[model samples]
Target chain A: MIAGSALYQTAVELNRRAAICIPEDARLAVGQLCQRETHSLSRYVLEQIMENYQVAVAEQRPMCADTGLPRFYAKVGNEAVVEGGMVGLEEAVRRATAEATAAIPIRPNRVHPLSRKDQNNNVGVHAPTVDYSFEPGVNWLELTVVHKGGLFGGDYRMLFPADGVAGLKRFLLDSISEFFRRGMSCQPLVVGVGIGGTKDVCVRLAKEAACLRIVGDRNPDPDIATLEEELLELGNSTGFGVMGLPGDGAILDVHIEIAYTHTGGMPIAIQHFCFAHRRATARIGADNSIEYRGNPCWFTPFYRRESISFQPA
Target chain B: MNNLEDLKLREVRLRAPLTEDDIRSLEIGDVVFLDGVLFTGREGLYSQLFDLNLQPPVDIRSLSNVTFHCSPAVNELRPGEYHIPAVSATASFRFDKYIPLLFERYDVRVIIGKGGMQKEIYQSTFRKYGAVYLTTVGYGLGALYGRGIRSVKDVHWKEELGLAQAMWVLEVENLGPFLVECNAQGRSLFEMANAEINQRFEKLYAGLPQPKLKRLGEVTSPTCEVL
Candidate 1:
């Protein structure tokens, strides 16, 4: 029998992962405004996030007080297996997640959107999206995990039209603009542009796009890269000030997952991932090929708050 | 919060341009019950206006001491209905897009939102044109209601964004428990909150290995600050 110790350690790591986030500077700005200020309106929502952080800590409460439906992304190596790793990976994650949550005092934020009753953050039919990209010969439990707790679950959208005339930039701009007009706040305004693929595949592809590893950076493809740049610029210009800042706001990264799309049309839909992007993504590689990029880098991230005694003047 | 019976509200059409003479004379706290017509455009409208290099949909010259914000009307509105309330939806951020334009093209004054604003916009627009931004309750939709018959006018990007409708209404007694942060002057608590989230993100990511350092207070962003 695979001893349960492996499960315990993994859970601890996941808990640590829960409290951390790595939103890039640009993307961070957008998230703040998108949360309350709306998208397309401001350039400096990240500033508001600093103030909000103070509120979350001073209150000693969950940020936004809306702990989200837990979503974990665990990347594992092909050769490196947990010693006595017999209990299925899914079970290990589920079990570990439950225990770690308790240890960290993570808020019981999972609630039925309709019923308004807390679910105590447990997995029902499909609570966590366990995504795995297999590495050939890596060993050791090395993974990066990040989750967005306060946000509402983001929706999954596919923006590819059958006619195929509307360019990617047009679709993305239209999608984001519409999201802001809805008048909702703190809702993660992430656009998962699934290109290529046929029918369902396109949507599935789009869903994958929503979980980009690099957050908001350019895509590898040249055509997609251009569109990404244009949309990013247009999104900030919407004058929708994020977190309520006036003009130009930081937006969470825009991700695009492209497959071989059908020739019929270009259909791009916008999916609003909950209030905070509480989904965590980490990799457990035995070979250690993937390393943290930035200085003082580690696979882990942190959360911040400040003294309320000193207010911004 | 007096009922409409006690409040002074009636509709008035724009016969000529409203000058500073109109805005300066109004009392500071007395609720200005506006009738006649106003645009119901939100973000898309803002984007379109930005594209056109203009202010809002209303005839600018005729707008003085006018309020600009996004609001959705609850309760069905018929052609000649007497009762309906236009509740403020999202406090807009696009005011920057049109604030200067409003002051320049029309001596329009007054905007609305759920929080305070930056000083420059306030001074540049309000100080110059006697305009000020009003902060309304962020989620007090039910609190604002009165009756007026109206419907949507033109929608720019109507295909994706629905009707950029127009509705006329009477806002009642508690126009809002909107946070005190909102006023014409300029200062955004929202900006501070955004900055806080960014800094904490750095600290949280850095301290992941040392999980013992985790404190719920440090782990999450705060909920209330606006007094």
Candidate 2:
């Protein structure tokens, strides 16, 4: 059986891994861009970001100080048995978050919205938010932890059905430009676009796309995939290279996820994931042994040449 | 495409208790590697410095040269002993209101942060106090941390504002390779970049087909180049 204590330990381990590790894919993308960039300042910025990634990973320190809000995506099997009920599981995760905040020593970034008060620990109401999905006939638990709390980048908009594809392109470009003007959301950024859903659904999808999809992944639908590529090219052309400097590539990738929407309205959310791209996934087997990997594989049916490191505990 | 091919950048080394001449010698587009005592503070600390009118725990004139606009990730071992693990620059314009006051009251000759500041504030601060704005690398926390930071000398309001927002006193050696965004002469690289980029954006936006605005939602257009 999967014990609540084991789940707690898993959460802490996931947080630690997410803080320290910059996936090999992001490094490769930045490294490749550095070679192509002609602007001395842009190249220098990319080099510096790369160096930071390497040092942080080796030292097991956070790649960025804004070790953002801890968010988790969990896939639970209906067939799985737990040592304690769902409430017990939530309590374990919360305890683990406090432990990781101290152990990984991430800055306490949470505060009460109304009172403007901070606990000096990265815990608050509905924080370290978890999105759950149940899979039938499987007896394993899959949890993916994403560091989405960074204040660097995020924006959303709802459009009339008449806005169409051109609307998406315009809105997205404008949003990226606005973010660039406001000091940028720490580039080379991963852009996620959610189209054709309700406001909440599109925003959530965009966040998932930003935090979950690996760089270089494409949408399964050909038309959506084309839009993603077009947006990526356009965003990169903004000349807001690394740190709003000048460079060839501003965006690392653009992932678009879509769903059916009202005939009169189309909601689009444009979410930016900074270069940190910190995430980790773990699977707790029915036997209670945990296996871990770097990415959550949210956008499957895509290609990734980089290998995922699986550690068993 | 504002060809920076001919951008001549001066290389400089700055020490704390910087003088008017030291600030004057700098120009927009110059590069500086700073040496001396540096301190960290951000939005929360800015309120303490300006709104509250409360004195900082450390004598401002004693450190007296550079103040970084950042809230670093720190690990506190005890009451005073702390380990700075990661630090990155934040947007400067967020605290533009307090910046001029910082230069006026304190002997701060240079302010370090990322994403540059508004032209009016930079020009005013420079004209009045000969203070300059230097931009450190953004999103490169490890590189910033790797600089010759000696130790955390003191901290103010850790209990109230939390570690990131708390004011910190630090001693540094050759602590930067900062890009000069604004100089003591009141020239700003950010303003220059904006003008050039805006012109390019204008051209780019013009190339796109104009849409007919028939409804409230569709009418929202990209306001040109004024980030």
Candidate 3:
């Protein structure tokens, strides 16, 4: 059984990693963008961003002061068992979040929405939310933490089936036009598109698509993957570059995620993962050995299975 | 990697408590780094000073004429000692209503933050005060900016406003790579970029059709900004 202590320790470490380190996948993408960028001003901005990444790692400081809203994604194995079950694991994560806030010295951004009262620990009612998905044939628990800025760059809309792919493209363009101006969304970033499901689920999938996946990974479905490539091309063709300056491209990659929804409505959501792009993942084995990794491997075949039943591949 | 020094963008450095000439000399799109002291402020400080009519805990004009819209990743190392590892600007557009108060009451000459305010603010308030706005690059270069901070000059209202919302005065050496988003002449770099960007919007939207249904208060014009 995985001890709660191990969970707590790993959670703290995940927070620190997410706070200080820009994952290699994101780093490489930005590095390449900086090198190929043609516009002098946008290229200069990208260069400074690259330098900031180096300084953050060298000095062991948060890449972004906003630190956004810190949250977690947990993938649980069918055979995994913990010392106190799911509740204990949650407790461990919550305790670790508060501890890491003060220790890593990340700004305690969470506050009471109406009262605006701050606990100064980044923990409060429904703060630092944890989302979960399950997989079969393993006994390890995998956790990924994402620190995403919330003020801008996410929108949802309902479209009829008749609207189709053109409508989807239009919506993506609209979001880009809305938030990408003045670098409000902080461009040269990833764009995540969620194609279906209930409104909330669609938004959630969009966020997960943006935050959970590694830079280069694509959806396994061929048609959806093609859509991802098309949207990416369309997004980059906007002539919007870093800080909303005109240049080669603003988007690093486009990710599309989908789920079955009501027959009449084709709801969609768009989320932008900015250059800060801070996230980290780890897998805790049944033996309690923690292995850190850049990729979260969130969208398993089982997780996206369409049939009523799920089977291990 | 390309050498940043080779870039053609004009760069300038200025010390704080700037004079009218110091502010007016800046041009839109010029890169800037700042020296001397600056303080952090946002809605909390704004409402306190403007709404609550609370006198500033310290003398504002004497401290510095520069204020940053930011909150640092800081920790109290000892009873009154603090350490900040990273600092980045917050979006300044939300505090638009307080700009006049800051300029008139505090005589603030320099504002540094992320993004920037609407063009109207620059034309009216900023132009009148002879102040310029500098926008932090990457909008998240917390570590790079943090390195320029020489010391924590003071902190106020920690208990009342909480750490994130409290007023933090910092002494900085070369604190930025901020771009001049809004200059004293009331020109805005973002507005200039938008004019060029908006020209391409028509072609991008030409093949796509409007949605069958629209939400209330939806912006129909592709070229219109929602800000």
Q: All models: lDDT? A: 0.40, 0.75, 0.90
Off by over 4 Å in 3: B1-8
Q: Give the per-residue Cα lDDT of candidate 3 at A53.
A: 92
Chain A TM-scores in order: 0.67, 0.91, 0.99
The predicted structure with the larger lDDT, 1 or 3, is 3
What TM-score would chain B of candidate 3 score versus the native chain B? 0.94
For candidate 2, the docking band is: acceptable
Candidate 1 docking class? incorrect
Over B89-164, each residue of candidate 1 has an lDDT whose tens digit, in order, gives: 3445545666676556545555555344454566565666555444442222221321221333322233333222
- Model 1 chain B: which ten-residue window has the lowest total lDDT? B2-11
Candidate 3 per-residue lDDT, tens place, A72-164, comes to: 899999999988999998889989999999999899999999999999988899888889999888999999988899999999999989989
How well does candidate 3 score on lDDT at residue B55? 94
For residue B65, what is the lDDT in candidate 3?
Answer: 90
lDDT of 1 at A248: 39
- Fraction of true inter-chain Cα contacts (below 8 Å) kept per model? 0.01, 0.35, 0.78
Name the candidate that leads on TM-score.
Answer: 3
lDDT of 2 by residue, A1-313 (tens): 8898889999999888888788877889878888888877678767778888888877777887776788788878779877786777777777888888877877778878776587777788997677876665679888888876455577777777777877777777777667765346887878888887788989888888888888888877898898899988877776666765555667889999987889988888889888877888899999999998656765443221123542222
